[model samples]
Target: MKSQIRVVWALMWSRAAVLRSDPERGEITTTVIVTALMAIAAIAIIGIIVAKLTQKANSIDLG
Candidate 1:
């Protein structure tokens, strides 16, 4: 049983190492960064639109 456990542990460790060295990892990081930037840009655009609309609304003479 102990030998079986050791073999399983070794296999898991090797798999982890293989995953850690994968070249595709950078693609995921790049994708996440791009998505975050796009989200931030969208929020900024919405804020600008809201501000402009609010300014326009306040300028209407209600008197």
Candidate 2:
């Protein structure tokens, strides 16, 4: 059982090394940047909507 565990670990290590050396890793960076930009845009849009709603609410005459 111990030998089997060692073999499994070795295989996993080698696979990780191969992935680390891959040339296409930049794709992950691009995906992260795009996701961050989208998140920022969504936050900005929600902020603008909330500001407009608050302004309209405060403009009402309570007297």
Candidate 3:
């Protein structure tokens, strides 16, 4: 089990090192910006959904 973990860790470290060494700006920058925009959109949508649900729940007549 320990050996398997070590092998996986080593592989991850090698890939990280490769990314760090290569400074390709275009793809990485575009990817980061798109990811951030998508995250913000998701949060806004979730907030709207929660607000709508709360409003509807409060309007219910549960006597």
Candidate 4:
């Protein structure tokens, strides 16, 4: 997980550097693709967390 986070950070930093160095390079397509991928990953992570929480809540022995 830590490595995955680091990799993402690195990719974002590199993308930002490219845009910073060449503002008129027209990297919009790349930017859009990366943003969509990140959004999807965030949704998936949230879903997993919600599912785990729901499962644990259901297993509680509260009377």
Candidate 5:
């Protein structure tokens, strides 16, 4: 079991070394501003939906 674990670890390290050595960033990366805007929009939509649902449920007066 220990030898199997060591072999897996060595393979992972080797792959990482290759990826690090040949670093390449193509033109498909979104900027920080776009990412932040999308996140905020998603959060706002979720918040509004949850708030409206809660308000509706509260108005029902379920006892």
Candidate 6:
């Protein structure tokens, strides 16, 4: 059982070191792009809502 465990662990590490780079690069690129896009979208949405609210506030006659 111990030898079997050692063999499996060695195989796992070898596989890990081999297919590590491309997947890591792809994951990082995807995360950065999604994060940037989400921030831009959030800012634009908030700006639009704020502008509409400002206009409405200015046109009110609350006397």
- The local distance difference test score of each candidate is 0.97, 0.98, 0.94, 0.95, 0.86, 0.92
Report the number of the highest-TM-score candidate.
Answer: 1
Cand. 3 Cα-lDDT: 0.94
For each candidate, what TM-score against the reference? 0.74, 0.63, 0.61, 0.59, 0.48, 0.60
RMSD of candidate 4 to the truth, in angstroms, is 16.1
Give the lDDT of residue 4 in candidate 1: 100
Please state the error at residue 26 of candidate 3 in Å. Answer: 1.4
* Tens-digit lDDT string for candidate 1 (3-49): 99999999999999999999886798899999999999999999999
Error of 4 at 19 (Å): 17
Cα deviation of 1 in candidate 6 (Å)?
Answer: 50
Clashes of each: 0, 0, 0, 0, 0, 0
lDDT score of model 6? 0.92
Q: Which predicted model would earn the best lDDT? A: 2
Q: Model 4: what TM-score?
A: 0.59
Q: Give the TM-score of candidate 2.
A: 0.63
Better of 1 and 5 by TM-score: 1
Question: 1 or 2, which is superior by lDDT?
Answer: 2
Residue 8 in model 4: shift from native, Å?
Answer: 46
Candidate numbers, best TM-score first, in rank order: 1, 2, 3, 6, 4, 5
Displacement of residue 8 (Cα, Å) in model 6 is 33
- Count clashing pairs, candidate 3: 0
lDDT string, candidate 4, 1-63, tens digits: 999999999999999998789966767888999999999999999999999999999999999
Q: How far in Å is the alpha carbon of 23 misplaced in model 3?
A: 10
Specify the poorest-scoring 10-residue window by lDDT in model 2: 20-29
Supply candidate 5's per-residue lDDT for 39. 97
Where does candidate 1 clash, by residue pair?
A: none
Question: Cα RMSD (Å) per model?
Answer: 1.9, 3.2, 8.9, 16.1, 8.4, 3.7
Extract clashing residue pairs from model 6: none
